[model samples]
Target: MIVASVPRTWFEEAVVVFFDVVRGTRAEAGQVLLPDGRALPGVRLVEGEHLAPGAVYEAEDEDGRRQDPERLRIVERRAGSDPAVRLEHVLGDEGTVTVVEGALQGIERPVAAQLRGSVRGLGRWGSLRRVHGEARVGLRAWWEAAAGRHVSGTPFEARLEHRLAEATVWAVPRPHGAGRWKVRLELSLRGRSFLRPVAAVALLLFRNRLREAFTDRVDRLAQVWNEIVLDTVSQDKSRLRERILDAAASPPEEPLL
Candidate 1:
C-alpha cells in the first residue's frame, strides 16, 4: 500500500473547484496518459452515486492476465464541517485499500486538502502478506526574499512499507512568478531479504535511468493536471499550455509495459 498527497496549482483558482470538478467527472481507467506518451488501459469507473458515505461504485481493470472487477465504497463523508470524503477500494478476494481527503487545518487561502491512503493484502516477494502506505498534502506560506512577497503552494509527502522494502517520496513546488512553478522531488528506497540485494543491484545498474523515469512521471502528472484545469475551466490558452495538452493526447511511440 502507498499513500501520497499531491498539491497542484491551477491558474490562480480555488483548489476546491478543482477537486469538485474531478470528483464530478466519470473517471476512465487505463486511459491515463503517461509522460512517455504511453497509455495504461483497463480501469474505469463503471458506476458512481453522488459523493457520500455508503455510496457504492463499480470498476473494472485488466490486471495483465485477465479482467478484474472491483467495488468502491464510500466510507465517510463530512460535508458540513471540513467537507471531506473517504473511499475504500474492495478487490473481492484479493484485498482492500482506503483513501481519505479533507481540508487542512489553519490555512485557507490556497484551499489546501490532506490526502491519506492505506492498503491491505499488498506485498512483494510472494508471501501473501500485507503492506501499508500513507501520504499528506497541505498548504504553506513562504516569503520570497527576492520578490519581497508572500506566496503559497502545496507540499506533498508519501511513504510506503512492506516486509521486504520501503519507499518514500516528497515534493515541494516553488512559485517562480508569472504562474510558473518549479518542483523539487526526492525519492528514497530501502529493502531487506534477498529482494533487497536484487533491488540494490538493479539500482546500482539503473540508478540514472530510474531517476529519469521518476522525474518524467512527475513532470507528466503536473502537465496532465494543468491540462485538465485548462480544458475544464479556462478559455484562454497559451502556446506552451496548448502544446502540453496536445502532447498529453498524443499516441504513445511504443506500447506500455
Candidate 2:
C-alpha cells in the first residue's frame, strides 16, 4: 500500500504481470542482448520458462563479470494470490544457504515477509567453522510510498520468531506525510539454552548501536528501492519487459538510467 493511489486493482494487475517480468530474466534462445547491443554470454535457461520449480540456469558470477560461474536452480515457486520463489546458491553437493525461506503475503497487496535462514559458515573461518549455531529468524518488513497528499502504509505486528543471538525482523510502513514515511525496525535476541548468557551480554552491549546502524542502512535502501520504482514507472509502459530484461542482464551497480 505504499503508493497512495494504488488500490486493490493495481495490486492485482501487478500480480498478474509479475511473472512476465520475471520471465524476462531468462536468456531467451540462450543469449541476452543488452540495450546497447552488447551480447551477454554464459547465461541461459536450461529448463522450464525459467520460472517453474527445478528450472536451472547456468550463469557466471555477477552475470559473467566474475570469472567463477555457478548453476542456480529454482528450488521452489508458489503462484497465486500470495506468491514467492526461492533459488539455491548451488555449491557442489550441499546448499550452504539452503534452509532459507521467505514469503510475501497480504489480503490485497504485499504487506509482510518472513525468513528463517542460516549464517553459520558465512565468515568461513576454519577455527570457528565448528561453532555452528544457525540463525533462524522471521521478519515482517514494510514498504511505503506517496502518490498525492498522503503516504500509504501497511501494518504489521513486528513479531519475530527467533532462536539465536538475534531475532527475526519485519516492517510496516507508518506514514509521516507526502513523499515521507517512517519505518520502525525492531530486533529481539533470544539465544539457545547454552548461549543465552552470551547473547544477553552482547545485546546489552551493542543493541542500541546496532539499531542505529541498521536504521540508517534501511533508510538508504528504501531510497534506492523507491528510485528504481519511480524510474521504472516513468518509462514507456510497453517497454516494461525490455527494461526488466536489460536491467537483469546488466552487471551490478549499473542503472538503466
Candidate 3:
C-alpha cells in the first residue's frame, strides 16, 4: 500500500514544465473566441450537457486513434465577453477531463485554473486533476487512484498499474517581458509498496533525461500555439477555425531524447 502523506518518504519522480513565450500574448485567446467574446464564425460547439451559466463541451471527435480527448470545440453562446467555457478533455479510453472553473480565462492567459477528470480503463481512477495556474503563486493538487486488474486488450493496449499513490503538478510563471512569461512546470509522483525504492532509484538516476523530454514536449506545444496566434491578422473565422483544428489534429511530435 502507498501512503498518501510524506511521499518524499516513498518512491518519487519529478518533472518541470519550463518554457518561454516568444510569440504569444493575452489577446491571442481571441483566436478561439473573439476579443469581444463570441465563437468564431461557422464554429460549432462540441456536444455536452448544459448547466445554468455555461454548458459543458467534450471532444467527441471519433477519428484515427482517438485515445485522449484532445479534440476541438468552439466556444459559443456564452455570457458576456471572456465568458467562462467548460472544456471536457477525453482521457484514455473511458475518461473525461473537465475544466469546471476558472479555466476558460486560462485559454488566453495563465490564471487560476481548476481542471478535474475521471479515468476508468485498467481500473477506476477518479479525480485526476491539474487545478491551478496562478502566476505568482504555485499550483497544488491532491490525487488518489485505484489499481488496475485484469486489463485486457490488443497487444498494444496498456495494462496500466494502479500504483500511483499520489501525484501533483504545479505551474509557476513570472513575467519575462512585454507579453512574455517564464513558466516552470513541476510534476511529482509517488509509487506504492515494493515499487517505491526500486522505481524511485531508477527514475532519479535518469532524472535529467526526463527533464529533457518534458522540455522538448513543451517546446513543441508552444510552437503550435504560436502558429495559431501569429497567423495573418484577419477576422476570417473560417481561417481561424481551420488553424485551431489543424493544431489539434496534428499533435506535437513525440518527445525525442
Candidate 4:
C-alpha cells in the first residue's frame, strides 16, 4: 500500500526495517539480495497492452535462473485506469495455483472469525495526540483435505476484512489442490488530514515522528495477527490450531487497536 503522508525520513527507516524483516540486503544498482542468495530486481514499469491476457511468460529467479513458466491473465483492464492481473502457476503432476487481483470483493462467504480493539495515545507533541478509535477484524477460513475428510469445516473460499482505527485489511484464500492454499491480503492505511491547524503544524514540524508513530502502531497490530493466526495456519500444528479456534470464538473485551 502507498502512504503519501509518510515523511522521507520515516519512509527510509521503514524501508530499512522492511528489508531487514525479509532478510534482504541492499545490493549495487538498486537490487536486493535475498536470504537464499537470489537477487530481487528493482521495480520497472511495463506497458499494459504489451502484457496480453492469457499469455504465459517464462519465470526466472533474481539470478536469472530458469524456473517454471507462469501464466498471466488480465482480470480487469480499462483505458486510463489501473489493470487487475491474474497469475497462475502450474505445478506439473501436482495442481494449478491461481491468484486473481480484485477477486476478493466478490466473495460472499460468511465471516468465521472476528476481533475488536481500540487504541489511543498522546505523542511527544501535544498536537500529535491520537484519537481513540475502534478496530474490527473478521476472518473466514476453510480447509479442504487432499483425499480424505475435509477439515476446518469452513467453505473452500474464505474472505476476511479487518477494519482498524487507522487501516483496513482485506484477505481472500484460494485453494490449489494437494492441500495447498494461497491467500491474498491487502492493507490500506487511512490518509492523514492536513487541513486542521494542529495537524498542519505537526506535519510541518514533526512529520517524521508522526509517520513513525503511525507505522509503529500499525505494525504492532499486524504482528499480533501474524502470531495468532497466520503463523498457526502455516505450521499446521494441532495445538496451535486450538489456540486460533479459541481466539476466534472468544473476542477480546479490551480494545486492541
**CA RMSD, predictions in order:** 9.6, 6.8, 16.3, 23.6
Mind giving the per-residue lDDT tens digits that candidate 4 earns over 1-257? 11112122332333333333343333333333344444433221122433345434333443444444332334343321222234433332232333434322112232332222222222343233323222222232332222223345333332332222244445344544443334444544433443345545645787678667766765675566555444434443434333433443342353111
Error (Å) of candidate 1 at residue 26 is 16
Q: Each model's number of backbone clashes? A: 4, 6, 3, 4
Native-vs-model 3 lDDT?
0.35
Whole-model Cα lDDT of every candidate shown, in order:
0.53, 0.50, 0.35, 0.36
Which prediction has the highest TM-score against the true structure?
2
Off by over 4 Å in 3: 1-111, 122-162, 165-167, 232-257
Q: What is the TM-score of each candidate against the true structure?
A: 0.55, 0.59, 0.38, 0.25
> Which residue runs does candidate 4 get wrong by more than 4 Å?
1-111, 122-165, 195-257
- lDDT: the better of candidates 1 and 4: 1
Shift of residue 113 alpha carbon in model 1, Å: 2.2
lDDT of 2 by residue, 163-212 (tens): 44435454444565654455555555567667898877877898889778
Clashing pairs in 1: 29-43, 29-44, 30-40, 30-41
TM-score of 1: 0.55
Error of 2 at 236 (Å): 5.4
